[model samples]
Target: MTTSNWLLPEHLSDILPAEARRIEELRRAMLDLYRNCGFELVAPPLVEYTDSLFVGNSQDLKLQTNKLVDQLSGRTMGVRADMTSQVARIDAHLLNREGVARLCYCGSVLHARPSGLLADRELLQIGAEIYGYSGYEADLQIIQLALDSLALAGVQNTSLDLNHPGVSRALIEAAGLQEQAGEVLSLLKEKDVPGLRQLFEATTGVPDDIAAALIRLPSLYGDGNVLTEAASALPDLPGIRAALQALRTLVDALDATSVGIDLADVKGYDYHSGVSFAIFGRGWPDAIVRGGRYDNAGSSFGRARAATGFSLDLRKVSAGLAPAEPSRAVRAPWNSDPALGEKVRQLRQDGNVVVQFFPGTTQSIDEFVFDRELVSDNGQWVLKSTN
Candidate 1:
């Protein structure tokens, strides 16, 4: 029996010509946008040592990473599951700038498993990062950039969900529940009020007020009023107060129409240390972009700079948009004439797509529309509308 040689593994696929072209166009446009915004471009290696790849990353990132042994050194190497950590490594160790460093990157990332049931294991991740800035100013800039990115991709009616882990983290630490931080965070993320109550009920040494605040987190999600309610509902721990204030500052600063606050939505990498965010398009189920402050992300790379950035799967963004219109092109006859060659070259130089077909070549390509054709009129090559 023979299996199909062209078949790809599950959750992996080849991007065909049309989709590939659209994704590439979007990539170039986004990179230009980043550049105009003062972000210097950087490209990190596709694979690195597991130690470096997994540095300060969450267990989710480690599990998602595809690992292998480097035969040259007989050491473990892994394909990056997320480029954020690699970008952090570059800022901390490679650039080593004392002042703020704005960097952007675009590349392929591999995951051992799909992020969702309909998701692919491979992604074209593109994003921008700002290093050496820790203020709400940095967070606001990152957030605006993310919103601008979505707009550039023609994604509209998007809403922003804001969350700060410090709020929940503060309660957990103040209550001496750091040992159960994982379980507590999991429950809160799911908004499992019952589970949280049960955990606090059985766990000893947690103050009643802290447990109550922990249980209330699942309910502390809504419009701007959530912040006011949180200020009154939750205990006034320094971490909680600071986190709420940070969220308040951003909510005030952002001009976006649909902004939300979800105190329990700490569903990102564990490295996210401050105000974190997820931007969602109107109809899409998942966030179109995710980013936030991770001041400690670079500590493992040698320098602990303040870092904030956002990343989105370019392929996913392309998939959600309408099919790209076929590019208009001029059909040219196959010829060895120097004049014809020069004419074709000049047209292409002027940014026109000119397709030259062989003597018996069939017109079958779907990526370009042959709207016009090059023809000989009185010994001069000229463009004639096919229509």
Candidate 2:
């Protein structure tokens, strides 16, 4: 006996109509936001050659993409786990002649389910990537644009925690524990401060200075005060100093009170050779949007292009919007004379959701029939209730 009538894979989720509408509205708003900023939107197929997945920034993403052999060629292809890599591939191969490309994408990206609803494998992702720019100004602009996109989605109180992957990479190499990079990063990603400390203790040939710096990375978050503290704390490490200066420069450029930089925060895509950032807001488990400079993501396509962009989880943004409903309080014409029936019928032709109640005939979303002058010409649009 088949006990299960049907089952959906654990990671998949459905977007209902109202929720889907909200998401679509957000997508339009965000795309328009980017389009206004000179970013041209492009989309890639859901599946592609396995190499396309690996030749980008995400090391873990390649393994997570859904894969199967193609029917005609008998070659393996994987569903993209992220859009950043795909867009980069397209830019390098298709738009290579162009000096730079500002690209955006909105669609579903598949990943192996991560044992949670929030990290569902089958998910809707709306994101963008800016490629072939050497300037960090491009990075700053994209991050700011991401914040704007979130604001456009009606997301409030978003915290933009900034970090430099190059800083962390330098710290790892400084500690002479480059092999421990993955373990240390895992700790940082989990916000496991104690775990990171233990990793530091486990590391051999570590300078006391670098060990201290590595241990402090996870807990560093706040306002401008956080950056000041980091400035004093990491005065000697070249990587940390460069990161601080970069952040200071970014801060000087930004004129908004809503944006803040967390100096001690370290997070990013692995190929973010320089700076990285994430955007957090209400209704999102972690950051609702994130992206960074993945210059090397284009190398797999045989071109070296610097890139930067950010994206919001469209489905999550959709989750926050209130649903809309059809109104049933439409007004219908009222009359005391029997000859007024024609007038009522004519009013119905205006498509005003008119309701005319006569024996065996009710015309409209709401009901409207008999009423005294006191209630009849109340000068309101809503129909009077007979009951």
Candidate 3:
């Protein structure tokens, strides 16, 4: 690349001042929200050993991770494409808390490629996690917390799509189609009815009931009523029945937010073993929040804990939201007087943004539109309104 083109790389750009301010404001608000909910903030390293980082059912994360050799140790180090795995490691090995542990994290994760045509290769991920809880209560709490976070960020007209991977997994296992499960799962994720039918038809010795169940999976999407339809349509396998009951319980408990169910929805099929959810705003094309229950993610760290959590891209959440109220600025004249310095310090200490004017400046200090100015009045320094 020529020097003239030495700007930002493809799918990557700097967040300028205005956007940066908005992102920071949202970040602080989200962290405060998590803190109030009893979640402790944790900052994991930007990179870690590839072996440890790729633990659990995270083949997608492994593909997205950017790998490089750590010269200091000669071992492959990977820039984290997701922070959930790191948090799991911390909970299982580092903190190793006995009871339920609530933790939150906010940081940048790098992806080797963009998620979509217009997606960024880097993202500011913020989320909260609950470990040591396996029941539907934990899932409901995390979902409610996610809704709260979106509300705090000013997201409106939101809808949540909920699913249980076990529903489809159970169907596949019961069908004796474990060998072709990967292909079947991919088709389900795409909602490709024709493709699924073709695959099933071409495959020999598929049980008639199982094939019919697989075909119905893609169409089993709608509001809470779909759960009833699913229960009646799917086979009488224990896992399938249990998953449907879980979804029904969640739907019955929810009141304020709009919810839907997609029995074939398996975005994180391999990673999330239980209920999975994605939040969609009115105008956003992609999900703003993606989370679910990944109970076995911490197994590699020597302890497997039941965990449920959600994460959102802070930058994306703040994109169309209103910026926070700007702080009042007090412009003070550049002077060597110790009293003047003390006054400036006092103003700042009282929660005001004070910008000192520099001597020999060509531009007017007032050009910055400071809300107030410190000037001599009646032979004493006083704050004069610039408005």
The per-candidate count of clashes, in order, stands at 0, 0, 0
Model 3 bad stretches (over 4 Å)? 322-328, 362-369
- In candidate 2, stretches whose alpha carbon ends up further than 4 angstroms from where it belongs are 3-6, 115-117, 263-265, 323-387
**lDDT against true structure, model 3:** 0.88
Report the C-alpha lDDT of model 2 over 303-382, residue by residue, as the tens digit.
88888877666876666555534334334445555545555555558754444445456454312233311134544333
Higher TM-score: candidate 1 or 2? 1
Quote the lDDT for 133 in model 1.
84
Per-candidate TM equals 0.96, 0.80, 0.93
Model 2 pairs whose backbones collide: none
Q: How close is candidate 1 to the true structure, as a TM-score?
A: 0.96
Candidate with top lDDT is: 1
Q: Write the per-residue lDDT of candidate 3 for residues 1-387, one digit (tens) a residue.
A: 556665777888887655787788889998998999899999999999998899776668889999999999999999999999999999999999999999999999999999988688999999999999998999999999999999998899999999999998888887778888779998998999999889978988778888999999999998998988988898889999888888888888897249999888888888998899999997677899999999978999899999999999987787657654455578888988888898999988998888886887644432234779999877678899988
lDDT of model 2 at residue 151? Answer: 77
lDDT (C-alpha) at residue 287 in model 1: 89
